[model samples]
Target: ADRPLLHGVSLRAAAGQTIAIVGQTGSGKSSLAQLVNRSYDASAGRVLVDGVDVRDWSLDALRSQIGKIEQDIFLFSRTIAENIAFGKPQAPRAEIEQAARDAQAHDFICEQKDGYDTVVGERGVTLSGGQRQRIALARAFLSNPRILILDDATSAIDSATEDDIQRALRRVQRGRTTILITHRLAQIRWADTIVVLDKGRVVAAGGHAELLRSSVHYRRIFSRFDAALPPAEPALAAA
Candidate 1:
């Protein structure tokens, strides 16, 4: 069955700004992200990019400038270098290596017996979650997207590998507009603006600090996140 998940949802991110969308599991966070690159078109209103309606842009043209990373990274049974260069097959080895380095994947890739020449199992079965994410990041870097979308991209990995992915993300995010959907407080706090959704509608939109002070929904979500962390993990805020 199909249903509309969002109602009159309106928001904007300035060029090079990072906007995070946060909400409960069914609050339409991912659905809203799906509209960005036009995975599904709005039934009514328009989605604009660079002042042009996304519907007006060719899919290939529109998608080429947008990169996305999700919780489950997909990779083919190809050489490591080939996987990283998937978006830009003509990319030279040096550029591929540079992208991997920027993604914090170079050293680890080198550790493989055949290094960049190693062929990963289907869907990257041979790689760790963090490794696959880093490879995805390397692919994104090579593609050089003008806009990047990350949907809980770090939520599944261990904290240690998460640190590496986060570092690579910071490097890759420069000079691009980023739409982030994450539960991690670390990722949420870095956004230029955080939009809180409740039951498919935006309940609040503001800086993290501002929302914490004024939006009950935001505070509730934050507290829930805080409570879910391990005992040793620092609270997102005081009780």
Candidate 2:
């Protein structure tokens, strides 16, 4: 009763589809996603992953089954290859390369003097933000999990690069359930379902068009995006 971050929030992420959660800061969107992997223990109800309560699953197994991409991507002080291979240490070199390629990282990676062997500076300081995100994505791709949680994962990349990243993501998302948490309506306008949260409760949930036409919460959020968008790229407004 005290914990209402996800109050009566009943939503489903069908297999092979993407679900996005939109909300203002502190609306508990992150809290809800964290519940999926038990990042933070829920104070109230259970979080089910693959039909089993997340608390009931082995921590390692549950984590490995879900790929979480944070807003701020963190990389270690190691060669690019090693960083991407961090998740699946035993993964073959070919698989590593394929993952980078799938993440649309191979092209830029090849430009590095040492290619995949290039040593990342402290905290990956040697790379650009977009490059870092791609590497992080490659790391996730290496795991090949059943579920993907992207927490504003593409916020730093340019629109063009974001498109490439989304394309790569589209390819990998087949048959995998995805939970995309973002404030940008443009990023999630195409999600299979959109859940809107306000003040730590589910205010509205439905397909983008459905909410756009019916939910006041959805309309307010869309207006925020409309104000954020550039006139030339009103395409993001289609949400």
Candidate 3:
């Protein structure tokens, strides 16, 4: 029998808003993101995009309008330009360069043996994890989808590299709906809304301050990472 991953989870985000999803290891966070792109059809509830049920839209048309960056990046054995251009095969060279620049990958890419023409090995095995992620980000940036979903996309990157990517993401997120699934408190703090999930259900929904003050589930999760967080909000003391 197929076990349900999420149960009665309903959430909403306005256009151009950023929503961060957080939970424990088995909390179905990634599964929730997958549903946005119809990666796995939900057995019960429906997923809507721009007021239309996603299932009703043509699969290619639906996916082409959404950009997804995951923790595990896949890069074909091709030149950096080719990979970035995969988003829009006929994209101009200048556009691909600009996307790399936006993704903070231009500098390193330029230093490569043949710059954009440098061919990578299978799955980007020749590049560092952070480098591969930046390439993936560049591809997404080139796509410029209406909705963006980031599922622990920066987990493999170091703190410094992650900071750079976050800066790039802030710029790309403008005017587009963004859904972030992450464990990083810093990333979570930037979201316009934060959703706390537990056992496939949304246990709490609000901004960082509000969740800290009202949700015990949130507080407990935060407590585990307290040292990494900034000063505890005074409101949390009374929660």
Alpha carbon deviation, residue 52, candidate 3 (Å) = 0.8
TM-score of every candidate: 0.93, 0.90, 0.94
Best prediction by lDDT: 1
In terms of TM-score, the best-performing candidate is 3
Of the two candidates 1 and 3, the one with more favorable TM-score, higher being better, is 3
Task: Give the poorly placed runs of model 3, Cα more than 4 Å off.
Answer: 230-239
lDDT of 3 by residue, 126-232 (tens): 88888988998898889999999999988888766878988887888888999999877888888999999999999999999888777777877777866764444
lDDT of 1 by residue, 72-147 (tens): 9989999999999999999999999999999999999999989999999999999998899999999999999999
Clashes of each: 0, 0, 0
lDDT of model 3 at residue 39? Answer: 93
What is the lDDT of every predicted structure here?
A: 0.90, 0.83, 0.89
Rank the models by lDDT, top first: 1, 3, 2
TM-score of 3: 0.94
Name the lDDT of candidate 1.
Answer: 0.90
Candidate 2 structure quality by residue, lDDT tens digits, 1-239: 46556676777777788989998778888888888888788777777876888888999999988988887888898899999998899999899999999999999999998999999998888998889989888988899889999887888887668778888767666778989888666668878888889887888888877777767777776677678632332223544
Error of 3 at 105 (Å): 0.5
Candidate 2 deviant stretches above 4 angstroms: 1-4, 227-239
lDDT of candidate model 3 versus the reference: 0.89
